[model samples]
Target: MPAFDPCYTLIVLAGGQGSRMGGCDKGMLTLGQQTFAELLVHRLRCSAAAFNPGYGPVLISANRNQQDYGRIGAQVCADLRPDFQGPLAGLEAALSRASPDLPAVIVPCDMPLLPDNLPAGLLRSVMADQRSVAVLHDGHRRQHLCLALWPQSALFSIRQRLDENQRSVAGWLAGQLVADVTFSEESVGALPFACNINRTSDLAQLPG
Candidate 1:
């Protein structure tokens, strides 16, 4: 087995309008008292500290709300694409900022209930296989485009796809040697991290 490398980057995509939540900023919505984005950053930071201590870095891709997210200590960046294309745009922007040699684990801002051991699992899988990309699968279907481990070699292809206006993450991964780390639903349960608060009704279901 290949020894795990502890020098990977974590990038969180947080630039969405949250139109499904009645035009609210999904990241700013409060789950308990703290905003969703704040809680996510805290969880990610904790997860990184515990699993990949002294790793590359943790960055957040913010849109017009860069200042608002900057207060949370994440290296804030703006999408270079003309419009808010989607999470892929954010990932591309993050790739440009990160060290090309270091791998990156990307997560979405709305998945507050992300499994605690995600980083470790992803690292293990990536090290075992020299694949350029991998993501999490829950047996049924893929999770949001939230979880992805990308290598530097992918930057060129990603940028080329963007230039061709192909913003679908699934399509991008289909062209790569992608691996899926499967998780049992029983182990994860119906947590908010996996459950995205897209609509008002979804937010209402959050644990009080």
Candidate 2:
């Protein structure tokens, strides 16, 4: 596989209300030796370095604890609409701040075991299919927020969707040319690719 360009932006979606996790900031939750945000940013840095020199800094979409998230050395941004307009709002916020011409790989901070191949695999699929988006469909379902790549051009459509009060990420993607990349258990080895920690119990299930 050809090395992916190092210019792609990494948008970490951490702006959720965390209702399922008892109103806690899932991104700030500790997993093993690092916080969810720290671990993700670190893993992505190493993963990107393997294919190229390095990737861009982590642009975290955070509604609260902006100062804490920023302390992790990531550029923290928040949704323009208040009271948690959902992931779409976070996506818009991060995309607007990203380089307008480059594509961005979006992931949720709660999914600590996101595949190392996510960014490169999605990029390749989108390029090969000439689509505007690429996202992981983990066998049974579309893990839209778990992992997805979006071209900067989609920013306009997203903004329009928000204006129309459509907050569903799936609804937004339904209108786009999406390349659905599948990551089977066999393909990901022991790693539970796209698995997320939505509750405190889910955290106990994390791989050691």
Candidate 3:
């Protein structure tokens, strides 16, 4: 609903070690017709068009299968610190590799059911008063650090956090001026923008 700059890079977070998912790259897991990373990019592209038809290309943050992720036709980047630093590090890597000309939208590859209007809505909040960050809050909780839109200004601050080893995504976000947009608890029978497949059982349950 909020107007925003159409040009922005989408950063798909897939660099985690996936400790809960048996130490495998969750993004490589298949659901429906393709891998999670591939499917995420597809859905994001479709969703982004509703907000900005000129939305910049997508980038995937992964520690493994860079070539495979790259095969998805997205710029593939890895975490700055190779010790599995978590999603914040993935976000940091994305910023480091992204062009400074546009803001970056960050989403997790595990979340295949992200809402269509999310990127646009978050962009509107950040672009409105020129805030550095904007995040989402489902009726139950704040998705916080991951599902958000950030301006070019966040690069340095994020770099600083990484420099000082501040790897807590929530902590870093707590220190910044962030705006929150709430969404309905669910859409139909599913959690809109919140269906993250984190376990083997989850992957097995994906809708056909």
Best by TM-score: 2
Local lDDT at 7 for model 1: 64
lDDT of each residue in 28-133, candidate 1, tens digit only: 7787788777777676553445555455577888886778787876788789977679888888888888866666777787776776567666666666665646
lDDT of 3 by residue, 1-208 (tens): 5554466678899998888888999888886679988877776653454565455778898999999998888888888787888888888888888777666778888887776567776776766655558887777777864455554677777778888988888888887888887777665243345767788877666666
Compared with the true structure, model 3 gives a TM-score of 0.87
Candidate 3 error regions (>4 Å): 1-5, 46-55, 187-192
For model 2, state the Cα shift of residue 28 in Å: 0.3
TM-score for each model: 0.86, 0.88, 0.87
Estimate the Cα RMSD of every predicted model relative to the unseen true structure.
Answer: 3.1, 3.0, 3.0
- Candidate 1 residue runs with Cα over 4 Å from true position: 1-5, 46-55, 186-193
What is the lDDT of every predicted structure here? Answer: 0.72, 0.78, 0.75
Q: What is the Cα-based TM-score of model 2?
A: 0.88
lDDT of 2 by residue, 1-208 (tens): 7667445677889999899978999999986778888878777643554455435656899998999999887789999888899999999999888876556778899888876667776677655553468878888788888544554567889999999999999999899887788876632333466777887777877766
